[model samples]
Target: MRVLIVGAGSAGLTCAWRLAREPSTEVVLIDAGVDPGPDVPSFLLRDMVLPPPFYWDYAEFDRGYFLPRGKLFGGTSAVNATAAVRGHPWCYDAWGSPSWRWERCLPSFRAIEADMQFGAEPYHGHAGPVPITRCELGGFDHALGDAYVRRGLARIADHNAPGHLGFGPFPTNRIGDDRASTLRTLLPELRGRPNVTLRPQTEAVRVVMAHGEARGVLVRTAQGDEQLLEADRVVLSGGTFGSPEMLFASGIGPADGLRTAGLPVHVDAPEVGANLVDHPYVQMGIEVSDPAKPAAPPGKGALLTFELDGPGHLQAHAFAYRTRAVDPSADPCSAAVTCALLTPESRGRLELGTGRARVRLNHLSSDVDARRMAEIVARVADVVADLASEGALRLPADPWWHADDLPAACRREVVTYHHPVGTCRMGSDTASVVDEALRVRGVERLMVADASVMPSLPRGQTNLGAMMIGHRAAEFLLEAPPP
Candidate 1:
């Protein structure tokens, strides 16, 4: 059987890796970005954000702020900070589907990572393609961790340990100084496989539909030539933004919106680009008390995940890193404490546009989210203030956290965590875009296996979660009896 998978990011690559191993399967994987080849730049592996020509030119969502998504071979997994967190068990249990519960999803998580720190644990796999490690804490990270411990939060040795949370060295997928993205791990294994074809610089224009089923895909080559790639099965692993855009391009979205865009409707799946959710964050800049003290190297250093005492258990993440990590032009002595609302009530939507797709992230629109995010900022600021008293760092003269209208300040300064999901929501009901098995509703021979299908955002970084989804997608396809 021939299978066509769209997008070569974390999910697409993982799905391809597993599916190509089947003797009866022939896999064709297409990506819009250029291949990374054998060697990727060492700097890209260290930095959380990547340079231009590597990202799609999506329009800025807010004032002078644009979301960055990797458009290359390994997709975001190659470009993102190698954070390999699995989030809390409650995250998966909240998906409302038994198939995606933490108990059901642990195996895939284990199968995908070779955890250096916890390999001996039954929950972690030691022989997976990707290698996971934790960074040793720098001086500032050590100080900040101590502050959290002073506040009575347990010092967690392993954040990826199921349901465990506290301040600790951030989990990352890396080998020494280099990144362990799919390009560096799975791609090497897939490169010489006879049954797998990797097509880079190829864009999926639309999934060709006939008799209410996906017949194939019409793709445009980098040189402008367009052709049909026929296959027995088509999987949309194009990611949160790209996957829904593909659905809209294929006229599988809301019929009214498709007709308005001058496209014929294939399926009236209204939720194609709805239910957009992401972590909304605001930062508190810090200045080193002594300029002579060397700043921590750029990129993620340490993380603190905790839940406030509340009804919904307001989940939040506090990351301490050099300001230059996110902005090269920023001050070398400057640092930042970013507070993000992990479980937000506010929902956004993406709409098809004449040019690029319109992404409206109504972040912090919900009162609860705004209030809770403000509380997080205030709480973390207090901790930082304690450090400042000890001559660690200096806060802004007019701190945003000090504003009388704290929630208002949060709304004015909110930024994306760059982890968008739920655009092509998956569930057990007909209203969901994809079913529990990851198959698109109202269509046959078509499936979506990426972050787009997440019903809700996981409580942590999504790269690991997306890869797990890919691993499971291939499992679902292979274990099923032949059609």
Candidate 2:
């Protein structure tokens, strides 16, 4: 059987690695990017624990644009902070699909993890393809974790375990000094496999469909040439924006929207590019009197879900790290805390621009969402102030600390956690693009394996969810009768 996976990101690599192991399967993975170069962002972030390779120079884009995703072989995982959180169990249970609930998804999660640390914990899987390890906790992380425990938050030894709510640095997808991206973890294992062919710098143009069934994809090669690749099946892992745009270009979205693009409507799935959700963060940097200790590096520490409720629900997810800027004479004496609003009432959408190929994200599109974000900022300020009162947490005297400045702060400082989801949402509902099994509704030989298939964003990061989807896709394909 021949399978073609589109977009050589987390999901595509996962699928390729799994399928390559099957004697009867032949897999071709195509990505529209360069090779997995040595200086890739994931490698830099994991080794140096710095924030440059993944973080774009926001000054280059409009102030509204934040957290630009990488277009490398490992996808955003190559540039992300490597925080491998499994999310709250309630996130899956509330996804409104039987196959997506925590009980049904845990096996898949367990199947892919290779726990390097905290293996004794019940929630984490010890033996798997991807390794999860705990970093050394610094003084700031230790203090922050203790603060959460003092405030009644449960201290979960392993955040990936079931019902993860507490203070602790979650396990990261890092193997020693290297970032354990799908490309690094799974691809290397399948490098010389006869059945698998990895084609980087090949952008998938559109799904090739015949009589309502997906058969292959048209790809543009690095040499600026277009070619058609045939396969028994096509899986879209182009993420929230790429997948929907591809679907729209192939006339597989809402009739009216497709019409606006001067294209024929094939599937009429109106929700293809709608219902977008993201976790927005408000970062607070503090300068400490002690200049000898720089912030602990990434993967070292994090505190999950510091809940504060009033007129609206506000959850402050804090990451305490040491930085060197605090004291030039001392070692590195600065710590920064970033609080993200997880359960925002606000929502957004992924819309095609005037040009059909262009995509624009309308973030913070709802008044309720904007207001809810404001409330979250207020609550975060309260938490920061509370921490400062104890004298251990020293927040900078920046005017951004004032609650009255939240609107400006929201505009200037808010950024995404890189967890954009629900564009190609999965559900049993007729309007959903994919079913509970992740099969494209009304389409045969086509499936979506990415965070875009998530019906809702999980409480934590989206990497684990993407990995789980890839694992589930493998299971579904393997269990089926030979094509």
Candidate 3:
């Protein structure tokens, strides 16, 4: 089997690692961004979110804000904070597909994680490509966590533990100080594989289809020459934004939108770019009570998760970190408590743009989401206030929470956690873009195995969930008798 995988991100790389192991299969992984070799910079390799890269042009529904999606070899995983959370079991059960339920998907989650701390546990895998370990927090982090405990947020034994909630360390994919990105882990294993080819700086423009099947992909090669790579199967692992954009460009999206965009419609799949969702983020700035105590670090020290509406309905992820708006040098004492709306009712959409997917993350569009986000922000502020009373922390004078109109403040400041999903929503129905097996509707020998195929957004960071999807896709392909 000759398989062509688009976008060498988390999912695509995982698929490559899985499929290339079979001698009968030949896999080609392509990415538009330049692939820095095994040894890349710490900022690109570790959890350091670099001063927004220029290649990240995907913006929010509000034109002013830019949504960052890493355009490099490892995609956002190469640039994101190394948070390796799979979220609660209910998050997966909410997908409404038995194949994707927590019970069925748990093995994939376990198969992909080589947890350093919880190796003996059945929920965690000890020998896998991607390394998972606990986040090592500092003194200020412990103080804030202690304050949260005092404020009634129970300290759980493990954050990744199923059904467990409250404040605990974020299980990150790291080895000592360095990161364990696919480039450093998964790719290295497939590097010398004779059947696998990793093509960096190669852009897949569109999937070439004929007779209701994907025949191959048209690409702009590294040297800027258009090339056609024929394949028996094509996997659209280009991620949420890139996958739908490619689909729309290839005339597989909503018919009216395709007509408006001057593209011929091949498949009138209305949901191709619809049902967009992401975890809307809210941040609260914090100051150290004593000037002597140093501020929190870049990555989250400890994380707290709780309910908004009810358990497994609307949840929020809270953590301590440094915000971009705060000057680290001038206000060395200032840090932030960031929270993201995990279960939002609001929906967003993606439209084809001149060169990319026009992402309309109508974040906080739902009044419920807007109000609930405000409530979470206010609740987090109240916890911080308790910390202040205990002489552990202080609040910024006239903080955004103190605004007379809290909802308006939420509308203004609600942002994305960079975890976008459901662009190519998966389900067991005809309306869904992909089936439970991730095969694109009305299309044969073509599949999507990235964050784009998620029926709904996961409750926590999506990096781990995305990799699990890729792992599951490879398993699906492997189990099925080859066509």
Which candidate leads the pack in TM-score?
1
Per-residue error for 167 in candidate 2, Å, reads: 1.5
Best first by lDDT, ranked: 1, 3, 2
| Colliding residue pairs in candidate 2 | 42-78, 293-332, 294-332, 295-322, 295-323, 296-322, 346-369
Give the alpha-carbon lDDT of every model: 0.87, 0.72, 0.82
What TM-score do all the candidates reach, one by one? 0.97, 0.88, 0.95
**Model 1 segments more than 4 A misplaced:** 47-49, 60-64, 291-300
lDDT of 2: 0.72
Cα displacement (angstroms), candidate 3, residue 270, comes to 0.5
Candidate 2 lDDT for residue 103: 84
lDDT of 3 by residue, 314-372 (tens): 78888886543234355766777887888988999888777667789888999888888
lDDT string for model 2 (348-427, tens) is 66665554333333344455555656676665566567667877667766647475756655756677767888889998
Pitting candidate 1 against candidate 3, the one with the higher lDDT is 1
For residues 169-207, write the lDDT of model 1, one tens digit per residue. Answer: 788888887778887889888888999999999999999
